[model samples]
Target: MPISEEHIGRTYPATAPYEVGRAKISEFAAALGDADNPAYSGTDPVAPPTFAVVLASAAWGAMFDDPELGLSLSRTVHVDQRFAWTRPLRAGDEVTATLTIEKVRARGTTAIIGIAVALSTTDGEALCTASSTLMHTSEEDAA
Candidate 1:
């Protein structure tokens, strides 16, 4: 089934707060092979720019779990990602992510979905906007 265009402009509730910790920052940096970077270590360390994905992914769960959307994780391919940040994410910050469906387009048996996740502090400070484009192939198209 094709992703419905009606999903566009829908906004899901904000996710539970995720606390940023120094150890997690270091761990993520190491996974990126950037452990040696001073910014990822010591007191007052900031997370890598792309670390917002950690929170954004959790927010996307709302969309994926919506039965009415009929989205299949097995058939989805993440094609693009972009982020706009007001400031770098730092350790000790409590963050929440809210996902919004921005656009949906169809071509043949495939659908391209655009989603934006807004990351904010528990206190309501804007952090970043993470946008992603995903392509979902119908069962027949995938075969």
Candidate 2:
């Protein structure tokens, strides 16, 4: 079955609080092979504006793996991404991100799903918001 507009408005709770730590920041930066990025390095650590990808990667699975939405994980492609930052993430902050399905649109061979994910501290202080557009291609489009 193809993705339907009915999947819109689905919202999922925070997967888990990802603690921002100096070591984790270094590891993330190192994984990307960008150790020279000042914000994500050093003892007094701070992270890049888009460091929220760490949280997003973990939280995104809920939607794709949702059987009700009938979204095929294999056929989906990340079409676009934008990050809006309220502050730079620093060590010792525990952050939680909730993924919300904001919109779903479909035409002949493609479905565009938009999500607004909120990344905030346990006390509700927002660190950043990531908005993504996922394009799930139909079998025809894939072929």
Candidate 3:
């Protein structure tokens, strides 16, 4: 079965607040081999730009868990990712993310999904928009 085109433009509810912490920021920067950057360490550190993906992934959980969406994580390939930031994430900032289905295109047995996650402060200040493209193959098609 194919993913319904009706899913396009569907926006999932905002995820629970995720508190940004200095340790987590340092960890993420270290994973990227940027641990030595001054901005990513010390008493007050700003998260690396791509760190929004952490919050965005939380928002994506809603769509992935929606039975009606019929998505299979095992068969999905993340093809692309882009982020636009209003401000860099900082430690101690509590944030939430809301995922929106931007576009859904079917190609043979595969579907290309375009998704955007809006990351914001718990107080509702927009922080960043993380967009990604996922290629998902239908179960029957994969078999």
Candidate 4:
């Protein structure tokens, strides 16, 4: 099934606020081969640049779950991801993310979907914006 064009500009609901923790930040740094930098992995209050993924992972589901879009996760391939931070997020701060479908384009048996998720505080302060570009190739196209 093809993804519906109508859902292109739809904005999904905000996810529950998440509190950043030092442990999680450390874990991410370790996974990325970073050996705990002071600004990102210390007890202080700074997070790595890519810390936005914590909220993005929670927000991307809204796009894949769009019932009318008929997007098949199994057939999707993450093409690229970009993030623009208005400010860095600190541990222990609660933040929410709202997902928006930015664009959709089809190519042969494949499709490209762009989604932008905004991470912000509960009081409506903008934190950062993450954009994901996904390529969906039908099984037939793979074969």
Candidate 5:
């Protein structure tokens, strides 16, 4: 089934707060081949710019798992992703993410979905806004 136009402005539930820890920051930076950066690995660690994706991806998952959305992760291709941050994430910051579907367009057997994810501190301070475009190919042609 194709993504429905009626779902364009839908917003999903906010994710549980995720606490940023020094070990997790170090692991993420290392996975990005940035372990040598003092800012990400030092005693007082500041997460790199792209670290917000960790939280945003979780928000995206909620949308993907929504039975009403009719989305199939196996048939989707993430086309683009961008992030805007108010400040660098640092170890000890507890944050939660909420996702909103901004737009949806269909072409032939493919649907383009726009998603916006907002990350905020547990206390409600805005942290980052992450946006993505995904191309979900209809399962009928998955072969």
Candidate 6:
């Protein structure tokens, strides 16, 4: 079944607190081709802007596995992504992400799902808001 507008506004549970480590930040930065940047090489480094996606991506599993949405993992394609930050993530910050379904639109056998993820400090300070759109094509040949 295709997702509908009614699925919008559905919020999922918060993910477990994930501690940001300096090493991981360095690794991510280097992977993004910033290996020589001083900002990401120190013990108290600030994460690259896109690092929030690391947390958001993990929390997204819940939405895909939800039976009500009936998503076909194999058929989904990430169409777009955007991020809004109150502050850059720093190493040693403990954060959690909560995902919400902002919108669901369908055309023929294809569905576009808009997901909003809120990343916050464990004590409730806002960190970042990440929004993503995924397009899922209906499976017509799978057994």
Give the number of the best model, judged by TM-score.
3
RMSD of each: 1.2, 2.1, 1.1, 1.9, 1.3, 1.5
Clashes of each: 0, 0, 0, 0, 0, 0
Give per-residue CA lDDT, model 3, range 35-111, as digits (tens): 99999998889999989998998888899888888898899999999999899999999999999999999877889
Candidates' TM-scores? 0.95, 0.86, 0.96, 0.89, 0.93, 0.94
Clashing pairs in 5: none
TM-score of model 1 relative to the true fold?
A: 0.95
Candidate 1 per-residue lDDT over residues 19-118, each given as its tens digit: 9999999999999999999999987999999999999999989998887777888999999999999999999999999999999997788899999999
lDDT winner, 1 or 2: 1
Clashes of 6: 0
Give the residue spans of candidate 3 off by over 4 A. none
Error of 1 at 50 (Å): 0.9
Most lDDT-accurate candidate:
1
**Distance (Å) between predicted and true CA of 131, model 4?**
0.6
lDDT of 4 by residue, 19-116 (tens): 88988877877788885467775567677878898788799787778767767678888899999999898888789999988888877787888989
Candidate 3 at residue 104, lDDT?
95
- Report the Cα lDDT for candidate 3: 0.92
For 21-73, candidate 6 gives per-residue lDDT tens digits of 99889899989999788888766689999999999998898898888888877
**Model 4 misses residue 25 by how many Å?**
1.1
Of the pair 4 and 5, which is ahead by TM-score? 5
Task: Go through the candidates in order and give each one's C-alpha lDDT.
Answer: 0.93, 0.83, 0.92, 0.83, 0.89, 0.89
